[model samples]
Target: MTDTLLPESDAGNTSDAVHEDRLWCDNGWTARVIKNEDDDGWAVEMIKDGEAEPALVGPWTMGRDKKNPKPLDIGAFNTLVKTASEVLRRHEQQLHAQLHKRLTVESGDGSVEVTLDIVPDEDDPYALLTAFDALGEQLAQVKVAPNFKLSRAGAASWVENGFRRPG
Candidate 1:
């Protein structure tokens, strides 16, 4: 049954819902409604793309109106799916980005190359840029502060000017 939008509670009991429809997400995860066969409960299984098993499994319930959930509607279901997907996506993305990440930049003279390895620091969640030569010798290393952002040219200039740290 997919005619209604499951309330936050029902969304929690994804295993009991009958005829569960799967919600596709842009963040490389798939959410599916499944009857919790063991307990006859409603539940949702969120699985990562290309993975055989679900990354998360939770229960889903019907909306407060107690509408029969069947024949999932594309519009309403999409919105719910999108919201949930985004949260998972953000979490996965942040986790990955927190791991050892590198940003490389080539020097104007081609004599040096800069590799930025971003590490998460509670006090300063930024990266450290290690400038190295083609010969694989470290040249310069600087800590990119938490307030640092390279997306904005003004921010970059600020870092270059000593007003901020390059991130």
Candidate 2:
């Protein structure tokens, strides 16, 4: 796509910088085309501000000669930013799904909603197990190990055991 200069607000406060034919920086992100290490083709990397690694890295298009990489342009940069932002969003969603779980269990009193949320930290990982009565009043909240298993059966057992931490 042809290069299109973005509006000042969209491009942020910094002036757009074109480092080379294959690299451009704008709107707090950098798009760079590099030689593919696995193949003779080219690949593009999109890195956001203050990030040590690229949020997206994928194959790049070849130039008209089919040897050099296609030159970076405003349109290409904008597309790359959109793509890389989507990748980051999906990754965060997946991680949140993995770390948080919810279930409903039938108890003698009524149905209870149970939720297990894990905080995944490199140095200190932990989980919080919480239970709420049918009316949405919290019954109990306990800190558990990060690896604690959460399931319908486990929730039922916890409710039956007076909301005590399961061994």
Candidate 3:
């Protein structure tokens, strides 16, 4: 078979997709068709480059012979890439929401923004509780447990207590 060349932008993208019968790679994603472990069918796995786990995996259609898996083509590969990219995006948004939180509360002086940023360290997981005034000037910051809950009542209490460490 003739060797296919990628565009200039994708030429620099190493480990890219190559169109094949059961495998396709491009757009920073790889799609591989394999036998479904749970049944006598085929499955497609889409994995983003540099990621250890596949972003998406689902059943694949059978070929005309009705025994073998369908071949990977440009249209199918593009669709797989789009679906996998969406999965990664949603995952990142979820992780960010889990690791960071913010709340604004009214204090004696004015409104204060309280934020909790969690650091998921393997050995020493922790979170930082920070207070900022209306002018965006930092009022106080302290290390707290990663599970620190940032709520309106909690933030108001912290600001009222002179930004002391939450108990």
What tens digits encode model 1's per-residue C-alpha lDDT throughout 1-167?
A: 44455456547645544433444333344567677666655666666668786666666665455543233344534455666667678878988775544443444434444444667667757776555567877756777764444443433343345433442
Better of 1 and 2 by lDDT: 2
Of candidate 2, the 10-residue stretch with the lowest lDDT total is: 11-20
The TM-scores, one per candidate, come to: 0.36, 0.89, 0.90
RMSD each, Å:
11.7, 2.4, 2.2
Pairs with backbone N, CA or C atoms under 3 Å apart (clashes), candidate 3: 17-25, 17-26, 18-25
Which regions in candidate 3 have their CA more than 4 angstroms from the true location?
Answer: 1-17
- Model 1 stretches astray by more than 4 angstroms: 1-31, 37-40, 62-71, 101-167
Candidate 2 per-residue lDDT, tens place, 125-167, comes to: 9999999988999999999999999988888998899878888
Candidate 3: tens digits of C-alpha lDDT, residues 20-132: 88887777788999999999999999998898999999999999999999887767777888888898899999999999999899987988999999999999999999999
